[model samples]
Target: MKNKPQYAIESVDHALHLATLLQQEGPLRVSEAADRLGVSRSTAHRLLSMLVYRDFAEQGGDRRYQAGPVLRAAGTSGAPVALLRRVALPHMQQLVARVRETANLMVRVDASVRFVASVESDQVLRVGDRVGRVLPAHLASGGKALLAALPPHELAELYPDPEAAGVNLPKLRRELGLVRKRGFAINDQLTETGLTALGMVIPEPDGRPFAALSIAMPAVRFDRDLLSTWVSALSTAVTATDRDLAAAPVLGQSRGS
Candidate 1:
């Protein structure tokens, strides 16, 4: 057999790592960020300078850094779900206060569910959640609720392997069936032990669901009936938000060519 030429393996570059770090934790100083990334201070400064030139980060007094307005605008401009978050945060806060539990808004990004916004509960034993955390779709109540509203074929395409740990199709289908019947999904320590969650999907005007709302509580504090009540409240809030989104002006229409 003829020998084939070997292709060179590409190494991970500093610029890529720096970009990832900035995306994960913005408003970070060069020295502090360098310490986290295990790179030299000079190297981190250089990377920050490049990011500043590119309008990704802005240097403030005391050498602190914050995400530039351009970055924030880019995140929300053309994305409908991002706009949804901007509009839904107030309602989510109200719901969280009413239910006395942590509230979260999630959307499906590729094969994972990303938290767009969250309000932690005031209780001492609450789940500490934050935005930008991606969780496995199969194991999360928000993910299952969102998946329940997707088209069956699309759902199948997204989860080809039924036995995969995070994207199990069969399990998702069964859970989604239950969600469809009950109008919400429940997570009993599926993401973390002693943390329970209830979630419901918000459907668009065309009846397509692209996002979900969830409430998390300490398992010791809430039982099945209380969880169901929280789920009902979440569903009502999601419905009202969806109506408002459908009525509001589209965000990206003015900026496009």
Candidate 2:
């Protein structure tokens, strides 16, 4: 049987345990954490605060502590995620050069998408770095691109009840269908007013990847007539990135750990 160390450091143990809980069980409230850790609410809060400071935990909109980038990145330690960022940066930079807009690399996180890398345009009106930001999968172009590639059963699993999740199933389905047909997706100020993005899946050979590439720009600068040109640039970057991912030592990683 496993045995605890005789000289165990209780506070260290508690903090580590809390981090483990956040990594494994998703979000947790202060009271819930106290209950799970067998400690008082204040102590639990302190531990969570420390974790947050270290980027191991984050406070969600609902005031629950969830896994932060350090805990959730590439679903492992810094190595795999660093590898992903390394492999995607060059292509992303090229995409930004071609489109003269911001470019982002993201992976699906259940009903959301997390921007892992972003290259901002030189233009003063361009979008900013989106790293570590999360947005609804149905609203973000990269998220929609990744979502469109999932199998139906997996899609249903991710969106059990679209209405309950604040998603319009009928409309989302139509958009995903179009993405499948055209090999890309679009977000015309859906996530933020005056912002628009075009995205395409970054293919992975082993399985469907919850990953994609996108180009974001100010709405006024988005030229509908240039849709083909933007898509072509993103498609080329996605292709090169995908080709590199195929032979990489590290496998593709996505959100939600």
Candidate 3:
């Protein structure tokens, strides 16, 4: 008797599920992937092998799998920053034009702030920072704006070691209090000597902050009145940018999609 050939294979739903798992609880082992996906170890291995071959994921030294640079590049091609650049560039440019100070968009990652986009001010004493730079979240205006938005319990979780150098919970709480009261935060020579910055948070529709918009200038350039004006301008820019992002079809759908 002739035996029939088996041709069953995994579906796209399985692949998408595996991809989502890798995206969420990343750096998975074959056993871990199998358990999460409810598949056999060999099947998980085969799926991961295909994903690696396609550059969807990479295996690390510890034999765990994580999303590869290809996936990262693809995901960030139209990232929030990119969307912001398209939707909020004019507002950022306008802020820079009016204030003649460097305007930047930043997002918090762990205990640091990552500059996602920037537009340099047209002033002679410009600060000249760019995107992808990480700064201590405790020091920068944008960092404070982000930190001020986090829930107190989450903030405590983020800064667990109070005895560690540069970790001052009391000071941070005080700064955050001021930030919440004033609707903006300030960095006076905290990031770089002689530089000052003012920042405001860009809240989502639910009023949760996902990013910060800031303007950096020379400390000497801003007096108390000028600082107040800059803060107002920064707040305006953030509000306009938030509205623009809210109205953007691509960003609105992409976030939920």
Say which candidate scores most in TM-score. Answer: 2
Error of 2 at 62 (Å): 34
lDDT per residue as tens, model 1, 100-127: 8889888776566777777877876677
Q: CA lDDT of 96 in candidate 3?
A: 89
**In model 1, what are the clashing residue pairs, if there are any?**
none
Instruction: Give the lDDT ranking, best first.
Output: 2, 3, 1
- Candidate 1: where is the Cα deviation over 4 Å? 1-81, 164-168, 251-257
Lowest summed lDDT across 10 adjacent residues in model 3 is found at 1-10
TM-scores of the candidates in the order shown: 0.68, 0.69, 0.68
lDDT of 2 at 34: 100
Worst 10 residues of 2 by lDDT: 74-83
Question: What is the Å distance of residue 152 in model 2 from its true position?
Answer: 1.1
The collision pairs in model 2 are none
List pairs with backbone clashes in candidate 3.
none
Model 3 TM-score on a 0 to 1 scale:
0.68
Model 3, total clashes: 0
Error of 3 at 174 (Å): 1.4
